[model samples]
Target: MPRRSYDHYCAVSRALDVVGDRWSLLVVRELCSGPRRYSDLFADLPGISTDMLAARLKDLERDGILTRRKVGPRAGTAVYELTADGAALRPVLDSLSTWGTSQLGERRATDAVRAHWFALPLGRAIAQRIPAGTATVHIGDSAFHYVITEAGITHHDGPAATPDLELRFDLSTATEVATGVRSLADAIERTAPQVSAP
Candidate 1:
């Protein structure tokens, strides 16, 4: 099947033409952390059907946004990772996360929550204070780490092998910090989060 487009020559429209599908950007968001197997992607994305995930992955690959590669012994397993072009969408996702902060008033009963989902926004919120170090944040059972540098921040799923700092937060506090309702610095000062050097 052919892709539908606004057919406008504008840059935004062109970008949208590639990634404007319902679950495309969210797929990108999941991959932003690191390479993931198809099962990993499906498990994390709560409501998407298997067919839809497969279709989106194919579309993203065709557009040069990501690449699917075989890894491990006998090349039995495949993982999907972002191409450089797709990784460049980090700042774009950051901008949207910032913009959407206002809409995150409270977690609803129907909302699906994943701790790593807060990684990007929390990275942005804490970048200034912990300007150039790796931190592994634990929010309940889920863990993710961020590497901050002069270039920018990049987050990855799971814990860092040797994080300079470790932060532990309850989901509520983490959400508040990520959504800008509460400042990380304030959270630290108030002892709402447990922070340690490791």
Candidate 2:
């Protein structure tokens, strides 16, 4: 089936033609951490149906945004990873995240939350302070880490094996930090979060 398009000769329109579908960008967000099995993607995306998820994956793959490959000891496992083109969307995601922060007024009863979902915004906040280093952040029962360098910041799904700094905070504080309502420095100063060098 052919994709619907604005048929305009505009870069933004072309880009949207590829990723404007529902769940596409969110799928890209999940893969931003790293490659993930189909099951992992399905689990993280709360409301998407299995058929919809498969269709989106196929579309993204067809568009050269991602690729599925076999990995593991015997190469029996398959995982989906972003291609170079897909990884290029990181900045786009960052921009959208920044713009959407003020729109996140309050958590609703029906809203689903994930700890790693805070990684990007918190990473941006942390980079302003630390600038460069490995920091493992613990938000409630979930753990994620950020690696900041002269180049840029990249976040991962799990804790660093040896982090230069360790931060512990509750989900509320994390949400505040991610949404830009509270600064990480303020959170540290207020002692709502415990930060230490390890």
Candidate 3:
């Protein structure tokens, strides 16, 4: 068998060349929800410094993976969004998110940790994990019913008994696990979350 070289493969190399950096993949993930300006992007990614984000955006724009559009006449009011080619990566991003969540869910060991889950992709993914039927979820003091239907999981706000599965964790832990920062295994081993049997 011949040795595979990244440099020799145009297709593989081209994909990497476009999203070769560490933050580039995260940039793609952030844009998966929708388009946003640089400020919004930066706000979501607190750990990323301004200069580094600027560089990554520039590189992505140069590689045609992202498009920078002026929002208005005001200077520095530009929104960076994924191009058509970049939009094609949605499935890949979704798969990554799903895999990360599964791993985290499996890793959560104890039954006492609290998780503050963010909306959008993570919340949607979490909704899919419940057994198909009528149920409710109690995260901390909050509670929402998980009504399984042909469409998907729908939340109903009403007075309900203790949920079948109770997840507890702080805001940072929840976001970290949801965002793939802390694997479920790591959270279980570290934070010790308890997932009740349904």
Candidate 4:
């Protein structure tokens, strides 16, 4: 299929021309963490059809937003990763995440939840206090870690090998922190949540 565009000269329109689509920014969101295998992106997105994912990826790759590469020590597989231009979308994601927090009041019957899904908000929240370093968030059977640097934040699917700090909490508490309703400190004080430093 041919690509769609705003077909205008305005700056905002030009920016949107690259990222404006139903699942486009979200795909950028997934890649914000780092490189992801095609299967991983499909799985985490939830509800996105395979064809839709493929097409969006193609568009993104064509636009210089992301690149497809063969990864692994051996028996390599394909992974999609953000380009420098794509990584530049970090602030955009952060802004959107902050704005979207208010709308995240409740999870619907069809809503999907994953620890890493809250990475953006939590990473922002963590950045406020720590500013820099790595944090591993362990929630139930799942986990995610993020490294905050001078540039911006990038998350990983699982725990950091040597995290500066670790936060272990359940799902509800994770939601509370992510939504800005309750802070990690407040949650720790109230529930005696596990917080470790190494």
Candidate 5:
């Protein structure tokens, strides 16, 4: 089938018109996390000036991608929300994040901080298997240990002394498997994951 062409025949050009410059997608990402007051959004995204943030938001609103609502009961109170169209970009963002993580060669403290926390599928897997124990997960160069007790979940850097199970994987495979982009059964069959029972 022939590709459906835009009027300009330049998808990148059209997308740029909506989210062209810096901070536009980031603002959309922030809104995707949840509804936020303008101040809160500004605070969460570091290094974005108040004026630039406002301008980007205005542009998105103009493009019908975002909508600003008067949140509180009183006057002068407002919050930003992603429209249905805007919210549809979440999968794109998640794929980008997963891809970005896979491409990083030298892991940094921030990457550790980010991937150090479990993705939802991994979290659910760990939570189900070890209701009252700790486990260390090593995926590529990233490592993090989680302690699950009667209290709650506690995270630590690096491997645990002794874990009930050690789940080892390459970063990309692990991410794809965790996010359901790739099947876990397929990974198991393909030996993409090295699972150790302790």
Candidate 6:
């Protein structure tokens, strides 16, 4: 099938033509954490049907937003990762994350949570307040690590080798911090989620 578009020439419309699908940006959000195997993506994304996931992945690839790559010396598996053009969407996602914060009142029974989903919010919060370093965030059984530098922050799903700091927070606390309901320091003070320095 051919790609759909409004046939409009405006830049915003053009960008949306590439990313306007229901799950397109979420797929980008998943990739933002790190390269992920096909199954990895399918698993993390709770409600996306297998077919829809496949379609979105293909669309993202065709649009040059992400690429499929072989991993390991054996080439036994493949993973999806963002291209530079795709990675540039981080600021956009961040803005959305910030904007959407207000609407997050509570997680209903239907809501799904993934610890690594908080990576960007945590990265942004830490980056603003602290100097360059790494932090391994422990959110319950799940954990992820992120690197902070002058350029920006990026994360992967798992613990870091030797994170300069370690932070532990529950999902609610994370939500509060992520949504701007609570500042990072305030969240730390309220919940007193463990924060340790190397």
What TM-score fits each model? 0.94, 0.92, 0.52, 0.91, 0.52, 0.90
Provide backbone clash counts, one per model: 0, 0, 12, 0, 0, 0
Q: Please identify model 3 stretches exceeding 4 Å from their true place.
A: 1-6, 73-76, 102-198
Best by TM-score: 1
Candidate 1 deviation (Cα RMSD): 1.6
Worst 10 residues of 1 by lDDT: 189-198
* lDDT for each candidate structure: 0.91, 0.90, 0.60, 0.87, 0.68, 0.86
| Candidate of highest lDDT | 1
Cα lDDT, model 4, residue 13: 92
Clashing pairs in 4: none
Badly placed stretches (over 4 Å) of model 5 are 1-8, 105-198
Candidate 1 colliding pairs: none
For model 6, residues 63-130, the per-residue Cα lDDT tens digits are 99999999899998999999999999988998887777667677788899887777777888877766
Question: Which ten contiguous residues of candidate 6 have the minimum total lDDT?
Answer: 189-198
Root-mean-square deviation of candidate 6: 2.0
Q: Per-residue CA lDDT of candidate 5, range 1-198, in tens?
A: 222334485877787767757888878766764577899778767787999999888888877879998966685788888898887765566566556555655545554333432343454456666787877777777676667777555445578898876777777667666655666557555663477666
lDDT of 3 at 151: 57
How much does candidate 5 score in TM-score?
Answer: 0.52
lDDT (Cα, tens digit) per residue for candidate 2, span 41-66 = 99999999999999999999999999
How well does candidate 2 match the true structure in TM-score terms? 0.92
* Candidate 3 per-residue C-alpha lDDT over 111-168 given as tens digits, one digit per residue, 9 for 90 to 100: 3332222433334545556545554444456444445556554344432355554455
> What's the residue-level lDDT of 127 in candidate 3?
53
Q: For each candidate in turn, give its C-alpha RMSD to the true structure in angstroms.
A: 1.6, 1.7, 10.1, 1.9, 11.5, 2.0
